[model samples]
Target: MAANEKIKEKISHLPHKPGIYKFFDENGIIYVGKAVDIRKRVSSYFNRSAQHNKKTLKLISQIQDIEFTIVDTEADAFLLENNLIKQYQPKYNILLKDGKTYPYICIVNERFPRIISTRNKINDGSRYFGPYASVTTMNVVLDLIRTLYPIRTCTYNLSPENVDAGKFKVCLEYHIGNCKGPCENLIDETTYNQNITQIRSILSGNLSVAKNYFKERMAAAAEEYQFEVAHQYKQKLDLLDDFQAKSTVVSNTLSNIDVFTITSNDKCSFINYLKVMNGSIILTQSLEVQKKLDETDEELLATVIVQLRHEFESTSREVITNIELQLPLDNVTVTYPQIGDKRKLLNLSLKNAMYLRKEREGRQEKNKDLSEQREIRVLETLKKDLRLTELPRQIECFDNSNFQGDNPVASMVCFKNGKPSKKDYRHFNIKTVVGPNDFESMYEIVTRRYKRLLEEKQPLPQLVIIDGGKGQLSFAVKALKDLDLWGKIAIVGIAKRLEEIFYPGDTLPLYIDKKSESLKLIQRLRNEAHRFAITFHRSKRDAGTLKTELTEVKGIGLSTAESLLAKFRSVKKLRELSQDELAQEIGQRKASILYNYFHNVA
Candidate 1:
């Protein structure tokens, strides 16, 4: 028997319960999988020829061993799967790295509190309506408040110092009738407060009452010979007409949904979302990211469902591209309705995704064609030109910034699919080499970079470009060779003699193929990385505050200090932690020690 077959046979006796599973290769790489029935789901994978797609086939072949845990139900299993996926980032799962928790819209606590969309949701004293998808969408709805009702947008506080400031002065918003000049106290507090309440009701979609009140106001203003006032009210009514027309229809049947889309480029991928509620599309956002190291479409869809479930309450039905999740949709219907309104909606969403993918892919192909032409032109003119083994998917460029090496820093910026991935930009402080030693610093940075990559097992970039000439190029090459990552990543150094580029590994000045989409793309990526790296380094060198307050904590050395600071924003906040809270935040022993240290010192 094969090595993996023996292992799978051993675990064949696993109970048929809902839980997470772990798959391991002989080389010891871990890939965690999950299922509702651990025994059945796992055993299914053991069958070599039993129907599997391309991605699944690859995963099954790599599986050398299997392990699982039994949970209470499928729902519990779903949560466990996502938790494990996030903690481990398994090789075969989609990963959501939004880097931000969702934002909630809150009406703060006060007699006249501000309605603001905030990422921080606190129960201190406020009402929160939503964890909206984007700030832009939330703000768009908020902007409608002026047209809906006469809400006071001004600060209610009339401090003694600013009492005179509230004196009448009709601002532009007032002339436009968007505001009632509440900042100038033209409107009384009682009226303003009443207006605020009405505005809130309108925002909640109480359309009938809002329209009735507006009609009454328009009629009353006309009777009072206030033509301008009547016209303003008439305009608001017209605005509401537009608002209702554009607003999504809310169906009682569809309470909550997560619409999915899978889009891809020449390299990497994308998965977008349209989170519906009460039949209205409440939120539409791309999944944190569509692709990870070894993530596939179906696998990503599954991971997204599990991860998304963590952020939301359990829903009765899930609308998907197909039945992919381990969730038992037997009682819950999984219908790909052929001739109905549902199918039409699904098809529309799919078409939107396909169009988005094509647009992205088209741009990339255009850039690729451009880059190739540029490469040819350079080769023709210089007789020595850069050649790639494959079309560069990830191109990296390095640039340094410092004040005479006093605050020496370097950045490694990355581009994927001819576009800059600002998220992947990295910076390094010139630690080992001293004072204007660009070559040695480059060598140190490159060495440390590859060393980290080796330890972390991260995918290497397709191409590496340095923003300097032969000496810097040689330094980078030497570092890569020393780390034995030389041939794995392409190395190129670009230098400008006035407006001309001098290529690495050659003495000749290079000329790019003006007509090549690919060559132009490379230039764009290289230039962007250089710009990004310089911007980051300058910002650091400009601000002399590289030190963190966590360094002052007695038990917290650099690593622990950084971790503590990152977890709790500041040393002051860390100090605010009670013994129990501190223990929970960090650890009991460390927390106690730090607390005592601070107390005794203070």
Candidate 2:
């Protein structure tokens, strides 16, 4: 490897401490690696005939810059490196990636802390317990907490000074019995802190203490003959037990084991993650990605494992998947279980992955069918409204722009099966029309268009839309009749004022439903023709102005002017050239005269 000055300078600063290093280039970070000794690992690339493969050598050559984060141990380096890889997806490293950050359960730091789930982690002295894989689990925790404790959900400050000064009162939460008037200092700080402590323990999967507390309270209430209070306590105890029973933690022996399962088809893949802590699945999440390069299932699964584990901050000693994956992760036992609780965990993970994949597929198919139905309905409505024998699947629209007759032009836009057909579109230069007469311009284009189609033996459209009121439509009809093709084609005119549709042999115009898809389609066709014609007219006017201005020169004529335009493309470019530069194309005398005219030299 060639050690450029940048690499040598960067390596000189590398410390001996273990850390994660990132190789950044002009684009961004392209490679990331973890090492025990930062200086030795990074400098190894600079040695004579570098001790690395072709890919590593290529990566080394592109390393314009480098950065490192110091961690205390090799384990910390591994965790941090894996995390950086997942986040940046450095091209040189192979790691699973996910698109989102899973939510966490946070207990806010306030006089009366509220239990809330969030994707963003704020370091404001609050306790955050998770980067949960599934929001459902956090939701269940919140519901149980609300039922077990009469905590305040309000945003009022319950500071001792504020409460003593009588700045706040009990709100709806107190009246509804969801809070114990904490803002009014009815519930002391000591009792509130104790409840919050137990809640933290419950979230950490140590639910026995909280359950026992609720059970004891229930028993005391029953002994005191307070049936309603006893019932409430019993309900809270049951909720905790029921939540635990659903997951069915076999034993509290397992901790920090990540189980993954993946399902993929020809075009995409989905993965499910199960974060097993104290033998119960604490976080359940599934993510899907579109298959762009047709990656193997094993490769995709391994990538997902790294991403999920790192994102949830799992430093599990063991990692499990339904498939036997050969990953390069160190100090982690990657296993495929075949029987017992481990097997059950694998199966559950697989079930979730498969279920999510199926649900996504169903939603796509349902959306496609609904879209097709809406299109079909629009066509049917158009057919009925226009009194057509069949659907007008092929439509043509025309618009004329004259710029007050300086360079009259027209454009025709075609729509086949309700979509713009650019290949079938045509532009007319108003060749036979003398001036800005809309009726005459429309008649000329219609006649020439059909006459050529007849000569070429091409197909005719089911509908020809004229963008004007009755006068343009009448001229178009006259042209069709002159060609003895009046009854063969279905033609209509759209009035710009009220958007009224004019039919042949009908005095009154037909007004379609304003909100109808048919009206929208018709409007789209008219607008497209207008946009196309205006663009062509502007270009023609520009070219005409250029032709007139260039021809006004003493020695320039039609061919000379067009040739100069062909070479220069525009007047601005010709104006930018020097006299000697212009003399290379034209004679010295003509160049001098052109330069004199432009520079205002008499």
Candidate 3:
């Protein structure tokens, strides 16, 4: 009946086959893993005599349940584990952090198809190709396609019925000879379809087919003594040759291969993928995945291989990697080449991955240096401007928020070294103060904030900013004086109307130059505190409204009301929803009640 004994029994019954296993806690699945032998791999976690890292030990302690799926091969196990990790987003799996959707060339499926580039790949019978890595390269291909075949750029329907009915006019694209006016019936459907077929060949990286077609037409024109037609075909051939030359040519004999290489640091791994077609590199992409557990190079490479191949929609039968892997992909050859063009291709991919890693590291280092320098400069300027004894490295700002004396709240925003220290920020509901008494609310929050910090033996801020004129500032000063912190820590009040800074006992307020960095920094702190307070106030008011309105429905609770508010955004929108639409969100019974409530029906 014990948890450990149950886990042991479950492990003992695990099949000795390749599969993916999931470790679950009471809440949900926490980890997913792949194994060649499920029983052995699952048992390794329970080995009492072996030393486990803190994370591994923690993962073991939370294993309330285990579930697995048997697969036919290790590759299948790897793929299934990846899918499960993506679906559940388990805490202990390596996360692929790349969220970009590459551009694809879509040939619109219509009577007269138009080839264009798009980032969205919706399936409506349109054929899409090349989730291209470089927009410049994709544009080049698009230009070539347009130059070779004069397809329409306009978005007219161009149906046979529309053309026969004379419901369309020839656009400027037709006038400029860029489009063969299918809308005006100047180009037949069969001829346009034939041009699209050749374009498909070019986009698929089978340039030779398109070249041969042009060559045959040129020869036929020359034989017919049509010099002008032959010249045009010759020009098309020249354009194709120029485009091929611009591509990264590997070897004439090599075609339809995928190359992958990986480089990694302690925290993350980077993988580069190169898609080769017709002996040229057609696409190159780099991926970065954050490491959770201590995974080996082989494991990381395998995961990236599956992801990149699927993302690029690669159909190459041969896959080349920098290291040997037991992928066991059906009808696919996995190779690690040491000396040949394949090796060169793999080296190029590795260079790309390493370059990306170095660029990221360099950018991070530069940003850190710039941030430190800027922080020191701003803090030093502020200290000098305010005539403070110290640099005021830890500054806190307070602002009060209320709507006509309702749901009153205050916010305290902290800044360390001129940057927002969001973790140290606090929000206080005006517990002791009643009505729109800003001075009393300020006094209460200031007293409560530092009193708790002092009792807890936490460090106090170097500077405190009160977001009001002398009235609120005087109350905050009184609270600090009672706590014996007024002289030890510097405090000031900023007036919103004229940007006047008031000292504790000083009569006249100090006004730094309007363009001074020190004044700007103080403005930033004041604005941030006010923004935070306003956000808290709005949420509290919304909650109160939800309780008073939606929660009064016959069967609706707080959670249901919150859900309805989140879905419809406002009660007014909910009132506009039809009964069927409301039923789709909630059940019919609740929807009927809500509909009747909104409609004022008895």
Q: TM-score: which candidate is best? A: 3
**How many residue pairs clash in each candidate at the backbone level?**
14, 2, 0
User: In model 3, what is the error at residue 295, expressed in angstroms?
Assistant: 2.9
Assess candidate 3 and give its TM-score to the true structure. 0.64
Question: Order of all candidates by TM-score, from best down to worst?
Answer: 3, 2, 1
CA lDDT for candidate 1? 0.66
Per-residue lDDT tens digits for candidate 1, residues 1-602, read 66765776756778888888888787654667677778878877666546766667787778787778888877677677778877877777666773667776666666445566778778787876556667777786777764566544555564433545655456676777666665565666687666666666554545556677789999999999999999988887887667665655434345456566565543465556565554456666553354434455666665665565456433537664533444443244344546554555455556667767777778878998998676555433322345567556667787776775567888788876556788888888888887888899889888887799889988788778877787888899999999988788878777655333454467776556656554555566667756766777666653333234455655666776656655665556766778888777668888788888656745
What lDDT is reached at residue 265 by model 1?
Answer: 47
Query: Sorted by lDDT, highest first, which candidate order results?
Result: 3, 2, 1
The top-ranked prediction according to lDDT is 3
**lDDT (Cα, 0-100) at 508 in candidate 1:** 71
| Tens digits of lDDT, candidate 3, 140-178 | 899899999999888888877889999998988988889
Clashing pairs for model 2 are 96-303, 96-304
lDDT of 1 at 75: 66
The whole-model C-alpha lDDT of candidate 2 against the native structure comes to 0.83
Error of 3 at 345 (Å): 1.4
Computed on alpha carbons, the lDDT of every model, listed in order, comes to 0.66, 0.83, 0.89
